[model samples]
Target: MLSRRAALRFGAVAIGATAAAAGAAGCSSADDDRAAEPDPLLTALDAARRDADAAAAAAAVTPDRAGALAVIAAERTAHADALATEIARAAGEDPTLPSATTSAAATSAAPITPPTIDALRSMLAESQRGAAALARSLDGYRAGLTGSISAAVGAQQAVLLR
Candidate 1:
Protein backbone atom coordinates (compact mmCIF):
# COMPACT_ATOMS: atom_id res chain seq x y z
CA MET A 1 0.00 0.00 0.00
CA LEU A 2 3.01 2.33 0.38
CA SER A 3 3.84 4.70 -2.47
CA ARG A 4 7.26 4.61 -4.23
CA ARG A 5 8.43 7.74 -2.38
CA ALA A 6 7.44 6.24 0.99
CA ALA A 7 9.34 3.03 0.23
CA LEU A 8 12.47 4.96 -0.71
CA ARG A 9 12.25 7.10 2.43
CA PHE A 10 11.71 4.01 4.56
CA GLY A 11 14.76 2.29 3.03
CA ALA A 12 16.91 5.35 3.70
CA VAL A 13 15.72 5.59 7.30
CA ALA A 14 16.37 1.90 7.91
CA ILE A 15 19.88 2.11 6.50
CA GLY A 16 20.68 5.20 8.57
CA ALA A 17 19.34 3.63 11.77
CA THR A 18 21.31 0.45 11.21
CA ALA A 19 24.49 2.43 10.61
CA ALA A 20 23.95 4.54 13.71
CA ALA A 21 23.38 1.45 15.84
CA ALA A 22 26.51 -0.21 14.50
CA GLY A 23 28.55 2.90 15.15
CA ALA A 24 27.22 3.22 18.70
CA ALA A 25 27.88 -0.41 19.53
CA GLY A 26 31.47 -0.84 18.35
CA CYS A 27 32.85 2.62 17.59
CA SER A 28 35.43 2.52 20.34
CA SER A 29 35.44 -1.09 21.46
CA ALA A 30 38.67 -1.90 19.65
CA ASP A 31 40.44 1.04 21.26
CA ASP A 32 39.01 0.10 24.65
CA ASP A 33 40.14 -3.48 24.27
CA ARG A 34 43.65 -2.40 23.33
CA ALA A 35 43.78 -0.08 26.32
CA ALA A 36 42.60 -2.84 28.62
CA GLU A 37 45.38 -5.24 27.61
CA PRO A 38 48.52 -4.81 29.70
CA ASP A 39 51.46 -3.46 27.74
CA PRO A 40 54.22 -5.98 27.10
CA LEU A 41 56.73 -3.32 28.05
CA LEU A 42 55.36 -3.61 31.58
CA THR A 43 57.14 -6.92 31.97
CA ALA A 44 60.41 -5.36 30.89
CA LEU A 45 59.89 -2.47 33.28
CA ASP A 46 59.15 -4.80 36.18
CA ALA A 47 62.19 -6.96 35.44
CA ALA A 48 64.43 -3.92 35.34
CA ARG A 49 63.10 -2.60 38.63
CA ARG A 50 63.38 -5.95 40.36
CA ASP A 51 66.93 -6.42 39.08
CA ALA A 52 67.92 -2.99 40.32
CA ASP A 53 66.44 -3.70 43.74
CA ALA A 54 68.05 -7.12 43.88
CA ALA A 55 71.45 -5.80 42.90
CA ALA A 56 71.29 -3.09 45.55
CA ALA A 57 70.23 -5.56 48.21
CA ALA A 58 72.89 -8.06 47.24
CA ALA A 59 75.52 -5.32 47.39
CA ALA A 60 74.48 -4.55 50.96
CA VAL A 61 74.66 -8.23 51.89
CA THR A 62 78.05 -8.88 50.22
CA PRO A 63 80.46 -6.01 50.28
CA ASP A 64 83.03 -7.75 48.05
CA ARG A 65 80.89 -7.22 44.94
CA ALA A 66 79.52 -3.84 46.00
CA GLY A 67 81.18 -1.81 43.25
CA ALA A 68 80.00 -4.03 40.39
CA LEU A 69 76.58 -4.42 41.98
CA ALA A 70 76.26 -0.66 42.31
CA VAL A 71 76.93 -0.25 38.59
CA ILE A 72 74.33 -2.90 37.76
CA ALA A 73 71.81 -1.29 40.06
CA ALA A 74 72.31 2.12 38.49
CA GLU A 75 72.05 0.78 34.95
CA ARG A 76 68.94 -1.27 35.70
CA THR A 77 67.32 1.72 37.37
CA ALA A 78 68.03 3.77 34.27
CA HIS A 79 66.51 1.04 32.12
CA ALA A 80 63.39 1.03 34.30
CA ASP A 81 63.07 4.79 33.98
CA ALA A 82 63.40 4.58 30.19
CA LEU A 83 60.86 1.78 29.92
CA ALA A 84 58.38 3.64 32.13
CA THR A 85 58.75 6.75 30.04
CA GLU A 86 58.15 4.78 26.84
CA ILE A 87 55.06 3.14 28.31
CA ALA A 88 53.65 6.51 29.32
CA ARG A 89 54.42 7.99 25.91
CA ALA A 90 52.71 5.09 24.11
CA ALA A 91 49.66 5.41 26.36
CA GLY A 92 49.46 9.19 25.87
CA GLU A 93 49.74 9.73 29.62
CA ASP A 94 51.85 12.12 31.65
CA PRO A 95 55.38 10.70 31.97
CA THR A 96 55.71 11.95 35.56
CA LEU A 97 52.65 9.98 36.72
CA PRO A 98 52.64 6.23 37.10
CA SER A 99 51.26 4.65 33.95
CA ALA A 100 47.65 3.48 33.95
CA THR A 101 48.94 0.27 32.38
CA THR A 102 50.64 -0.41 35.72
CA SER A 103 49.26 0.92 38.96
CA ALA A 104 51.75 2.13 41.59
CA ALA A 105 49.98 -0.01 44.18
CA ALA A 106 50.47 -3.18 42.12
CA THR A 107 54.21 -2.51 41.83
CA SER A 108 54.60 -1.87 45.56
CA ALA A 109 52.55 -4.91 46.50
CA ALA A 110 55.04 -7.33 44.94
CA PRO A 111 57.57 -8.42 47.56
CA ILE A 112 61.28 -8.32 46.64
CA THR A 113 63.46 -10.95 48.28
CA PRO A 114 67.12 -10.06 48.14
CA PRO A 115 69.02 -12.52 45.99
CA THR A 116 72.61 -13.72 46.32
CA ILE A 117 75.27 -12.72 43.77
CA ASP A 118 74.76 -15.96 41.88
CA ALA A 119 71.00 -15.44 41.90
CA LEU A 120 71.45 -11.87 40.68
CA ARG A 121 73.58 -13.14 37.80
CA SER A 122 70.86 -15.63 36.94
CA MET A 123 68.30 -12.88 37.08
CA LEU A 124 70.35 -10.75 34.69
CA ALA A 125 70.60 -13.63 32.28
CA GLU A 126 66.86 -14.06 32.38
CA SER A 127 66.32 -10.36 31.88
CA GLN A 128 68.64 -10.35 28.90
CA ARG A 129 66.72 -13.21 27.33
CA GLY A 130 63.37 -11.55 27.96
CA ALA A 131 64.49 -8.20 26.63
CA ALA A 132 65.93 -9.81 23.53
CA ALA A 133 62.76 -11.77 22.91
CA LEU A 134 60.60 -8.71 23.38
CA ALA A 135 62.84 -6.72 21.10
CA ARG A 136 62.45 -9.30 18.38
CA SER A 137 58.68 -9.17 18.67
CA LEU A 138 58.47 -5.38 18.49
CA ASP A 139 59.59 -2.71 16.03
CA GLY A 140 60.70 0.94 15.81
CA TYR A 141 61.98 2.82 18.83
CA ARG A 142 60.63 0.28 21.27
CA ALA A 143 62.56 -2.54 19.64
CA GLY A 144 65.74 -0.51 19.68
CA LEU A 145 65.33 0.45 23.30
CA THR A 146 64.68 -3.12 24.40
CA GLY A 147 67.53 -4.43 22.25
CA SER A 148 69.92 -1.95 23.80
CA ILE A 149 68.83 -2.96 27.24
CA SER A 150 69.26 -6.58 26.34
CA ALA A 151 72.82 -5.95 25.18
CA ALA A 152 73.60 -4.07 28.36
CA VAL A 153 72.20 -6.83 30.51
CA GLY A 154 74.18 -9.39 28.53
CA ALA A 155 77.37 -7.41 29.15
CA GLN A 156 76.58 -7.18 32.85
CA GLN A 157 75.97 -10.89 33.05
CA ALA A 158 79.02 -11.91 31.05
CA VAL A 159 81.55 -9.32 32.18
CA LEU A 160 80.52 -7.97 35.57
CA LEU A 161 79.02 -11.13 36.98
CA ARG A 162 82.24 -13.03 36.38
Candidate 2:
Protein backbone atom coordinates (compact mmCIF):
# COMPACT_ATOMS: atom_id res chain seq x y z
CA MET A 1 0.00 0.00 0.00
CA LEU A 2 3.03 2.30 0.20
CA SER A 3 3.89 4.77 -2.52
CA ARG A 4 7.09 4.03 -4.51
CA ARG A 5 9.13 6.73 -2.74
CA ALA A 6 7.92 5.60 0.66
CA ALA A 7 8.83 2.01 -0.09
CA LEU A 8 12.26 3.02 -1.27
CA ARG A 9 12.85 5.13 1.82
CA PHE A 10 11.74 2.29 4.08
CA GLY A 11 14.04 -0.13 2.30
CA ALA A 12 16.97 2.27 2.62
CA VAL A 13 16.40 2.75 6.31
CA ALA A 14 16.18 -1.00 6.87
CA ILE A 15 19.40 -1.54 4.95
CA GLY A 16 21.16 1.17 6.90
CA ALA A 17 20.07 -0.29 10.22
CA THR A 18 21.18 -3.73 9.17
CA ALA A 19 24.54 -2.38 8.13
CA ALA A 20 25.00 -0.57 11.44
CA ALA A 21 24.13 -3.70 13.40
CA ALA A 22 26.56 -5.72 11.33
CA GLY A 23 29.32 -3.20 11.91
CA ALA A 24 28.71 -3.24 15.66
CA ALA A 25 28.90 -6.99 15.68
CA GLY A 26 32.02 -6.97 13.59
CA CYS A 27 33.78 -4.77 16.14
CA SER A 28 33.30 -7.58 18.66
CA SER A 29 34.42 -10.30 16.33
CA ALA A 30 37.09 -12.61 17.77
CA ASP A 31 39.47 -12.43 14.83
CA ASP A 32 40.07 -8.69 15.22
CA ASP A 33 39.03 -7.76 18.72
CA ARG A 34 40.96 -4.51 18.79
CA ALA A 35 39.49 -1.15 19.77
CA ALA A 36 38.00 0.96 17.06
CA GLU A 37 40.51 3.24 15.35
CA PRO A 38 40.65 6.97 16.14
CA ASP A 39 42.96 7.91 13.28
CA PRO A 40 40.14 9.08 11.05
CA LEU A 41 38.87 11.41 13.73
CA LEU A 42 42.34 12.70 14.44
CA THR A 43 42.94 13.31 10.79
CA ALA A 44 39.71 15.24 10.54
CA LEU A 45 40.62 17.31 13.56
CA ASP A 46 44.07 18.02 12.16
CA ALA A 47 42.58 19.23 8.91
CA ALA A 48 40.16 21.44 10.73
CA ARG A 49 42.92 22.85 12.92
CA ARG A 50 44.99 23.57 9.87
CA ASP A 51 42.12 25.41 8.21
CA ALA A 52 41.49 27.45 11.32
CA ASP A 53 45.15 28.27 11.59
CA ALA A 54 45.27 29.37 7.98
CA ALA A 55 42.26 31.58 8.43
CA ALA A 56 43.75 33.09 11.54
CA ALA A 57 46.98 33.72 9.69
CA ALA A 58 45.14 35.45 6.88
CA ALA A 59 43.24 37.59 9.33
CA ALA A 60 46.43 38.53 11.12
CA VAL A 61 47.76 40.36 8.09
CA THR A 62 45.66 43.36 9.02
CA PRO A 63 47.22 45.16 12.01
CA ASP A 64 43.92 46.11 13.60
CA ARG A 65 42.65 42.51 13.53
CA ALA A 66 45.95 40.77 14.24
CA GLY A 67 45.63 40.64 18.02
CA ALA A 68 42.23 38.98 18.01
CA LEU A 69 43.28 36.49 15.35
CA ALA A 70 46.47 35.71 17.23
CA VAL A 71 44.39 34.71 20.20
CA ILE A 72 42.23 32.55 17.97
CA ALA A 73 45.31 30.88 16.49
CA ALA A 74 46.75 30.14 19.91
CA GLU A 75 43.48 28.62 21.02
CA ARG A 76 43.28 26.53 17.88
CA THR A 77 46.82 25.31 18.43
CA ALA A 78 45.94 24.24 21.94
CA HIS A 79 42.89 22.41 20.64
CA ALA A 80 44.98 20.60 18.05
CA ASP A 81 47.46 19.62 20.75
CA ALA A 82 44.68 18.26 22.92
CA LEU A 83 43.25 16.28 20.05
CA ALA A 84 46.68 14.90 19.27
CA THR A 85 47.14 13.79 22.85
CA GLU A 86 43.78 12.05 22.87
CA ILE A 87 44.52 10.37 19.58
CA ALA A 88 47.83 9.15 20.91
CA ARG A 89 46.24 7.80 24.07
CA ALA A 90 43.57 5.98 22.10
CA ALA A 91 45.94 4.55 19.50
CA GLY A 92 48.73 3.59 21.95
CA GLU A 93 51.20 5.72 19.98
CA ASP A 94 51.99 9.26 18.99
CA PRO A 95 49.67 10.85 16.47
CA THR A 96 51.31 11.48 13.15
CA LEU A 97 50.82 14.70 11.26
CA PRO A 98 48.32 14.56 8.46
CA SER A 99 49.56 13.77 4.98
CA ALA A 100 49.89 16.21 2.08
CA THR A 101 46.46 15.27 0.79
CA THR A 102 44.85 16.09 4.08
CA SER A 103 46.80 19.30 4.49
CA ALA A 104 45.75 20.40 1.03
CA ALA A 105 42.16 19.50 1.67
CA ALA A 106 42.19 21.53 4.85
CA THR A 107 43.94 24.68 3.63
CA SER A 108 43.40 24.91 -0.12
CA ALA A 109 39.66 25.18 -0.19
CA ALA A 110 37.95 28.06 -1.96
CA PRO A 111 38.70 31.52 -0.59
CA ILE A 112 36.19 33.73 1.21
CA THR A 113 36.14 37.49 1.44
CA PRO A 114 36.21 38.87 4.93
CA PRO A 115 36.41 42.51 3.97
CA THR A 116 34.90 43.90 7.14
CA ILE A 117 34.82 43.19 10.88
CA ASP A 118 31.34 41.67 10.62
CA ALA A 119 32.42 39.45 7.76
CA LEU A 120 35.47 38.27 9.67
CA ARG A 121 33.34 37.57 12.70
CA SER A 122 30.98 35.51 10.54
CA MET A 123 33.87 33.49 9.15
CA LEU A 124 35.25 32.87 12.63
CA ALA A 125 31.77 31.81 13.77
CA GLU A 126 31.60 29.23 11.02
CA SER A 127 35.04 27.93 11.94
CA GLN A 128 34.03 27.66 15.59
CA ARG A 129 30.96 25.65 14.63
CA GLY A 130 33.14 23.24 12.70
CA ALA A 131 35.58 22.94 15.60
CA ALA A 132 32.73 22.28 18.01
CA ALA A 133 31.35 19.51 15.80
CA LEU A 134 34.76 17.86 15.60
CA ALA A 135 35.14 18.05 19.36
CA ARG A 136 31.72 16.43 19.84
CA SER A 137 32.65 13.61 17.52
CA LEU A 138 35.86 12.99 19.45
CA ASP A 139 33.99 13.06 22.77
CA GLY A 140 32.22 9.82 21.83
CA TYR A 141 35.53 8.00 22.27
CA ARG A 142 35.69 8.78 25.96
CA ALA A 143 33.10 6.27 27.14
CA GLY A 144 35.44 3.99 29.11
CA LEU A 145 38.20 6.50 29.61
CA THR A 146 39.48 7.37 33.06
CA GLY A 147 40.09 10.83 34.55
CA SER A 148 38.71 14.16 33.27
CA ILE A 149 40.42 14.39 29.90
CA SER A 150 37.17 14.50 27.99
CA ALA A 151 35.74 17.18 30.20
CA ALA A 152 38.86 19.26 29.90
CA VAL A 153 38.79 18.95 26.15
CA GLY A 154 35.15 19.94 26.04
CA ALA A 155 35.88 22.97 28.18
CA GLN A 156 38.68 24.03 25.91
CA GLN A 157 36.38 23.73 22.91
CA ALA A 158 33.83 25.94 24.66
CA VAL A 159 36.53 28.56 25.17
CA LEU A 160 37.32 28.45 21.46
CA LEU A 161 33.70 29.15 20.59
CA ARG A 162 33.66 32.12 22.94
Candidate 3:
Protein backbone atom coordinates (compact mmCIF):
# COMPACT_ATOMS: atom_id res chain seq x y z
CA MET A 1 0.00 0.00 0.00
CA LEU A 2 3.05 2.34 0.33
CA SER A 3 3.67 4.90 -2.45
CA ARG A 4 6.95 4.67 -4.50
CA ARG A 5 8.52 7.70 -2.75
CA ALA A 6 7.74 6.26 0.68
CA ALA A 7 9.22 2.88 -0.29
CA LEU A 8 12.48 4.51 -1.45
CA ARG A 9 12.71 6.59 1.74
CA PHE A 10 12.11 3.50 3.89
CA GLY A 11 14.83 1.58 2.04
CA ALA A 12 17.28 4.42 2.56
CA VAL A 13 16.46 4.66 6.25
CA ALA A 14 16.90 0.92 6.70
CA ILE A 15 20.29 0.97 4.94
CA GLY A 16 21.48 3.91 7.02
CA ALA A 17 20.42 2.26 10.25
CA THR A 18 22.22 -0.95 9.33
CA ALA A 19 25.37 0.93 8.47
CA ALA A 20 25.28 2.95 11.72
CA ALA A 21 24.89 -0.23 13.76
CA ALA A 22 27.78 -1.87 11.94
CA GLY A 23 29.96 1.21 12.48
CA ALA A 24 29.21 1.33 16.16
CA ALA A 25 30.10 -2.32 16.52
CA GLY A 26 33.29 -1.79 14.59
CA CYS A 27 34.31 1.16 16.80
CA SER A 28 33.82 -0.89 19.98
CA SER A 29 36.64 -3.36 19.19
CA ALA A 30 39.37 -1.10 17.87
CA ASP A 31 41.85 -2.03 20.62
CA ASP A 32 44.70 -4.09 19.20
CA ASP A 33 44.90 -7.62 20.55
CA ARG A 34 48.67 -7.61 20.19
CA ALA A 35 49.10 -4.58 22.42
CA ALA A 36 49.63 -6.74 25.51
CA GLU A 37 52.37 -8.83 23.95
CA PRO A 38 55.90 -8.43 25.30
CA ASP A 39 58.29 -6.26 23.35
CA PRO A 40 61.49 -8.05 22.31
CA LEU A 41 63.45 -4.83 22.10
CA LEU A 42 62.56 -4.03 25.70
CA THR A 43 63.70 -7.48 26.75
CA ALA A 44 66.98 -7.04 24.95
CA LEU A 45 67.50 -3.65 26.50
CA ASP A 46 66.94 -5.04 30.01
CA ALA A 47 69.35 -7.88 29.41
CA ALA A 48 72.00 -5.52 28.12
CA ARG A 49 71.49 -3.32 31.20
CA ARG A 50 71.91 -6.26 33.56
CA ASP A 51 75.07 -7.36 31.77
CA ALA A 52 76.49 -3.86 32.00
CA ASP A 53 75.63 -3.73 35.70
CA ALA A 54 77.45 -6.98 36.36
CA ALA A 55 80.52 -5.79 34.50
CA ALA A 56 80.47 -2.51 36.38
CA ALA A 57 80.20 -4.33 39.70
CA ALA A 58 83.15 -6.52 38.87
CA ALA A 59 85.23 -3.49 37.95
CA ALA A 60 84.18 -1.49 41.02
CA VAL A 61 86.70 -3.26 43.22
CA THR A 62 89.54 -1.85 41.20
CA PRO A 63 89.59 1.92 40.88
CA ASP A 64 92.57 1.84 38.51
CA ARG A 65 90.82 -0.66 36.22
CA ALA A 66 87.36 0.82 36.54
CA GLY A 67 87.84 3.40 33.81
CA ALA A 68 87.67 0.95 30.93
CA LEU A 69 84.78 -0.92 32.45
CA ALA A 70 82.98 2.35 33.12
CA VAL A 71 83.39 3.32 29.52
CA ILE A 72 82.00 0.00 28.42
CA ALA A 73 79.14 0.36 30.87
CA ALA A 74 78.31 3.76 29.46
CA GLU A 75 78.27 2.32 25.99
CA ARG A 76 75.99 -0.50 27.07
CA THR A 77 73.69 1.99 28.78
CA ALA A 78 73.52 4.00 25.57
CA HIS A 79 72.72 0.89 23.61
CA ALA A 80 69.99 0.03 26.07
CA ASP A 81 68.55 3.51 25.66
CA ALA A 82 68.52 3.06 21.93
CA LEU A 83 66.72 -0.24 22.22
CA ALA A 84 64.23 1.26 24.65
CA THR A 85 63.57 4.05 22.20
CA GLU A 86 62.86 1.60 19.43
CA ILE A 87 60.52 -0.38 21.61
CA ALA A 88 58.72 2.76 22.73
CA ARG A 89 58.36 3.97 19.16
CA ALA A 90 56.85 0.66 18.15
CA ALA A 91 54.51 0.79 21.11
CA GLY A 92 53.62 4.46 20.58
CA GLU A 93 54.94 5.41 24.02
CA ASP A 94 57.45 7.83 25.43
CA PRO A 95 61.03 6.57 25.42
CA THR A 96 62.75 8.70 28.01
CA LEU A 97 63.94 7.16 31.27
CA PRO A 98 62.07 8.16 34.39
CA SER A 99 65.25 9.41 36.01
CA ALA A 100 69.00 9.24 35.37
CA THR A 101 69.33 6.46 37.88
CA THR A 102 72.43 4.26 37.70
CA SER A 103 73.00 0.70 38.85
CA ALA A 104 76.67 1.07 39.81
CA ALA A 105 76.81 0.60 43.58
CA ALA A 106 79.47 2.24 45.67
CA THR A 107 82.44 0.15 46.83
CA SER A 108 85.19 0.82 49.33
CA ALA A 109 87.45 -1.26 47.15
CA ALA A 110 91.16 -1.27 46.37
CA PRO A 111 92.83 -0.80 43.01
CA ILE A 112 93.72 -3.89 41.01
CA THR A 113 97.22 -4.46 39.62
CA PRO A 114 98.67 -5.58 36.27
CA PRO A 115 97.70 -9.19 36.97
CA THR A 116 94.12 -8.08 37.37
CA ILE A 117 94.29 -6.48 33.95
CA ASP A 118 94.66 -9.91 32.39
CA ALA A 119 91.59 -11.15 34.18
CA LEU A 120 89.64 -8.05 33.21
CA ARG A 121 90.74 -8.46 29.60
CA SER A 122 89.62 -12.04 29.58
CA MET A 123 86.28 -11.15 31.07
CA LEU A 124 85.82 -8.32 28.61
CA ALA A 125 86.63 -10.60 25.69
CA GLU A 126 84.05 -13.08 26.89
CA SER A 127 81.46 -10.34 27.24
CA GLN A 128 82.19 -9.11 23.73
CA ARG A 129 81.71 -12.62 22.40
CA GLY A 130 78.44 -12.90 24.25
CA ALA A 131 77.28 -9.54 22.89
CA ALA A 132 78.11 -10.57 19.35
CA ALA A 133 76.19 -13.76 19.84
CA LEU A 134 73.24 -11.82 21.19
CA ALA A 135 73.33 -9.45 18.24
CA ARG A 136 73.28 -12.33 15.81
CA SER A 137 70.43 -13.96 17.64
CA LEU A 138 68.44 -10.73 17.69
CA ASP A 139 69.05 -10.16 14.00
CA GLY A 140 67.71 -13.60 13.29
CA TYR A 141 64.67 -13.21 15.48
CA ARG A 142 63.60 -9.62 14.73
CA ALA A 143 64.03 -8.79 11.08
CA GLY A 144 61.81 -5.72 11.40
CA LEU A 145 64.16 -3.79 13.68
CA THR A 146 66.04 -0.79 12.37
CA GLY A 147 69.63 -1.32 11.23
CA SER A 148 70.92 1.01 13.92
CA ILE A 149 70.41 -1.60 16.59
CA SER A 150 72.68 -4.07 14.83
CA ALA A 151 75.18 -1.34 14.09
CA ALA A 152 75.27 -0.33 17.73
CA VAL A 153 75.81 -3.90 18.78
CA GLY A 154 78.63 -4.27 16.31
CA ALA A 155 80.24 -1.06 17.52
CA GLN A 156 80.02 -2.27 21.12
CA GLN A 157 81.74 -5.49 20.22
CA ALA A 158 84.48 -3.61 18.44
CA VAL A 159 84.96 -1.32 21.40
CA LEU A 160 85.17 -4.25 23.78
CA LEU A 161 87.78 -5.90 21.63
CA ARG A 162 89.87 -2.77 21.68
Q: Specify the highest-TM-score model's number.
A: 1
In model 2, which runs have C-alpha deviations exceeding 4 angstroms?
1-40, 94-123, 134-162
Error of 3 at 34 (Å): 2.3
lDDT of each: 0.90, 0.53, 0.57
Better of 1 and 3 by TM-score: 1
Question: What is the C-alpha local distance difference test score of candidate 1?
Answer: 0.90
Clashes of 2: 0
- TM-score of every candidate relative to the true structure: 0.76, 0.44, 0.49
Predictions ranked by TM-score, top down? Answer: 1, 3, 2
lDDT for model 3 comes to: 0.57
Off by over 4 Å in 3: 1-31, 96-162
Q: What are the candidates' C-alpha RMSDs? A: 5.3, 15.3, 7.6
lDDT by residue (tens digit), candidate 2, 59-111: 65667656655665575566555556565655556446554434554576555
lDDT of 1 by residue, 6-104 (tens): 999999999999999999779579768878998899999989988998998888877889999999999998998899899998887999887654477
Model 3, span 47-116: residue lDDT tens:
5565566557656776765776677667666766666666666666656643222222114223423324
Instruction: State, as a TM-score between 0 and 1, how close model 1 is to the true structure.
Output: 0.76
